[model samples]
Target: MTKKLIYNGTVLTMNPDRSVYKPGYVYIEHDTIREVGEWPQDGSKQALLESASWVHDAEGKVIVPGLVNTHTHLFQTFIRGVSDDMPLAQWLRQIIWPSSLAMEAEDFYLAALIGCIENLKSGATYIMDHHYVHTYPENDDGVLRAMEESGIRGCMARGGVDLSYEPKLRETEEEIFANTDKLLDQWDGAASGRIEIAMGPLNLYGCSRAFLEHAAKYSERRQLISHIHVAETSDQIENTKARFGLRNLELLEAVGLLGPKTQVVHGVWLDDGELESIARAKASVVHCPVSNMYLASGVARVPDMLKLGINVALGTDGPGSNNCQDNLEVLKFTACLHKVNQLDSTLLPPMEVLQLATVNGARAMGRERDLGSLEPGKKADVVVVDLRKAHISPVHRASSALVYNANGNDVDTVLVNGQVVVEHGACTLVDEQEIIRRAQARVDRLRAKLAPEYPVFRVVE
Candidate 1:
């Protein structure tokens, strides 16, 4: 087996004790980390390093576990900057829904490729794509193909909305279940287990009670994780209460959807009792601070969630809303947003914010044991940040610099499953420029199609 060694850098283990080793080394054998610690002074270790197939000298760099984006819509990359400064309901109704209907299967593939390229360059190793824009079966296939080609670890939350206000996007209950079952059977554990499939009901506002009940039952029977948007806007809670006489979380609990294997996105408008119920069910919430802020959605009670021992993870939401897939930006925003909102600078420290992006995110995805931290026998998903930049010079504490100072553009090298996918801030697997060109071409066509009815937001380059 091929062995690789990365040495002579600051390694942030991000383990349970949050260890940091100056001028440390990590030994990797194929797809798993063999050892991670300070560089050995002994001759035996020196000899082993000399005999390795590949050695990466990470001098003047910071090595950390790859960031995880627990929730995002890959297909939304096509709709970036489409409907900004609008309310959530209007944005969804006018721009997002119409643009989604106009997209072909090829559009989804190109958009997903662009999203994956952005995520990789941003030091994100895994992405949970909550893709619910599939009007055709081929659209889902296109997304999976892009994930495979991009060589990023992906969780495809195959999504369907049974009660969408947009008629073209809605599906019958039987059709949605059939599509979900077919996708799971075909794609689960595909790409050498690099790809995972999860069940996703669009949301409480858009999916019927019967549909959610069926989704919950299917998830339980198949032991698959269930993901859905919850309490993202005040309208969602109000509409759910109006229809079912229960709040969003209450409706989810009544339909047997709240459990350890469920991940609720947003949760920005949840009350204290709802937070308690989520913590009690052992469920996780993914906080998308930038998206929430960009859309004018109120900040989530992240401090309250963390205080209650609920596993809170970080996400970028979607390219359409957030306009970027950079986890480093998300990390910084999570740290700063909570501090200011709570009126306490000590609320979310650098270490805790780092955890929210890495281990905590892994826990939310139920892959905590293998995917999160840097330890022996864990998957060698690693990112190397070049600290030689002027902005990141004279690193005080590696963790602090990583969260507060270093942006995603500082990411120099990235490895997923011990395979180097990005080097020197360039993707090794896909032609990034070509991907961008194709995505832009699709967007151009979409703008032409949308100009007649909706005023296309022209961005002058």
Candidate 2:
């Protein structure tokens, strides 16, 4: 087997004990980690390191596990900057739905490729794209193909809204379930298990109750994940209560959809009881601080959720809301937003914030054992952030500097499953510049398809 060694860096092992090794080394064989600890001093260890097939000197850098983004609409990358300051409902009515419904397969493919390049540079090796735009039958294939070609671990949570949503985004019963099954047969575990398929119902109000139950059961029998947006805004909660006479999470529980594999996205409006319900069901909540604030969707109860034993992960939501696919930005926003929201400086330190982006996100995708930390026998999904920049010069605490001062541009190298997908701050597998040009061109074309005013919120029912 081929071997590679990376040493002379600050290794942030987000393990159970949260170990940090300065001037450390990690040895990998093939795609699995073999050894990781302090730099070797003894001759035998040094000799063993010299026997590796390849060695990378990560001097003046911080080596950490690749960040996992639990929730994002990657296809929305094409519509970024479409509507910046609009309210959440209006933004969806005007920008997200209109542009998404206009996109074809090629649109999804190019958008996902662009999103992958952005995500890779930001140190995210694993991304869950909550893709539901199904204008064509090949839309899912387009997204998954980009994920495979870009060499990043991804989950296309194929989402749908059968009723009470945009009419064009919905599909017939046979098409929805049959398409899901066909995708499973073709691409569920493709690319050596790097690509995973999950069941994603767009939202509670958008999907019917019976469909939610069926999706939960479908995923449960297969041991797959079920992701959905839950109580993201006050209107969502009010509407669910008005129609079903039950709160969002309560309605989910009544439909037998609350379980450990459920990933609740943008859980901003959940109350105390709903938090308790999520904790009891062992579900994970994906906190998108930047997107929530951008859309004026109030801050999520992240501090309360953590204190109540609910696992929380971080996400950027989508480009339309966040305008970027950088988790480093999300990390800083998550820490700062909570600290100020709770008026406690020590609310979320940089170390815990790193966990929210790394381990907590891994748990949300049900890949805790395979991903999340740098240890022996785990997948070699690693990222190297150069701390030698002028802004990050003389770094005292590596994690603190990474969380507070660093952004996506600080990442110098990234690896997914021992493959160097990004090197020297650019994607290695795809043409970054060409993707940019094509993506911009596609966005311009998509803009032409939308009418000037769109009749003001006619997309939403």
Candidate 3:
């Protein structure tokens, strides 16, 4: 393994002690960390230095474990600002569903590529994309190829639904299964551990019990996470209760789908019993605070869940709901929103909030052993923020500033598995100008074709 040294930086570590605000150095050996902190100049350290293939100056940057986005629709990066000012159900029915139905394979690839660039530049090293818009099997391969080309780690969930956003979205179960099988076979473990495939049933209301069972069985056999949308809204919960005679989480549990590998998104309306169920099942939740606030969905009892020892991670959801795919914004919003909601300034402190974005997210996606922290034998997934600036200067507390004040524009560099993917606020894998042009053009065409009555596209320059 090649060795690299990153010297003269403040390492956040996010270790067990929640260590913060310390000047330290890091040693990287290929995909794993060798050592961190200002160590003694001993003989063993000399030997490690002699083995180094390269060295880089961190130059007073703030080093944190790469952010993890546990739930996102990367393909929806093109839909930013489209379905604003609506309830979740209405947003899905009137705008999101129609736009997705109009998407083609090229559109999926371009959108996913741009989403990857946005995520990496914002310091998120890993993404769990709940891809639900594949109209055909070929698009699945297209999306995974885009993820590979962008050079980010991802968990791709093949979104399946027996029903559609409207009567128009209904595909035969055969079609769903065919595309799903194709997705799992092609995208699972693609790109040498940079990408993974999982079962993404759109939501409980849209899928039949049999489909849920099949997804659970397949996920278990493969030891993959079963990602789904559950209890995101009160209406959905009520509808599920009225139809299935149980709440959404209860329905999922009754169908034998609640387990360690299950990851549910939003979960704004999960009751105490459901929280207990999640705690007992060792399942995880992806909390999209910005999206939930945007849609006016109730605040997900996140503090309660945290107190119950349930694993909760941060996600931006999608551009349509979040209006942007910035993990830095997610971190800041998550940290402050909960404190305000609970009427206590101590709700989610900087250390705990940072953990939600990194280690907790890795645990949710079943990649905790490999991708969460700057520890030995873990992947060299890391991000550097320029803390010399005025906003982050006078660093009394690294976690406090990172979680409360820092933004995506402050991210100076990002690395995935020891490779530099984003540098100086731009992606190394794809051309930024070309991506913007193609994204704008695709959004225009889609608007013209699907929502002509809305307006011609007017993207801000």
The candidate that achieves the highest lDDT relative to the unseen native structure: 1
1 or 2, which is superior by TM-score?
A: 1
TM-score of each candidate structure, all chains considered together: 0.98, 0.96, 0.94
TM-score winner: 1
User: What TM-score does candidate 3 get on C-alpha atoms?
Assistant: 0.94
Overlapping backbone residue pairs in candidate 3 total: 0
Error in Å for residue 319 of model 2: 0.4
- Local accuracy of candidate 3 as per-residue lDDT tens digits, 1-461: 77777666778887777664355667888778878776343544566557678665666578889999888898888788864688988788676877778888888888888888888988998998898776755677777888898889988887778753466666667776677676677667787788888878889888888877877777787777888999988988988887789999999999878998999899999889999999999999999999999999989999999989999999999888998889988988998888888899978888888899999998998888877777767888889988777877887777777887788888988888888788777888789889889888987888778755544233334
User: Comparing candidate 1 with candidate 3, which one achieves the higher TM-score?
Assistant: 1
Question: Model 1, range 240-269, lDDT digits (tens) per residue?
Answer: 999999999999999999999999899999
Better of 2 and 3 by TM-score: 2
Q: What would you estimate as the lDDT of candidate 1? A: 0.89
Spell out the clash pairs found in candidate 2: none
* Candidates arranged by lDDT, highest first: 1, 2, 3
**Which segments of model 1 are wrong by more than 4 Å?**
41-44, 457-461
List candidate 2 stretches off by more than 4 Å. Answer: 41-44, 451-461
Candidate with more favorable, higher lDDT: 1 or 3? 1
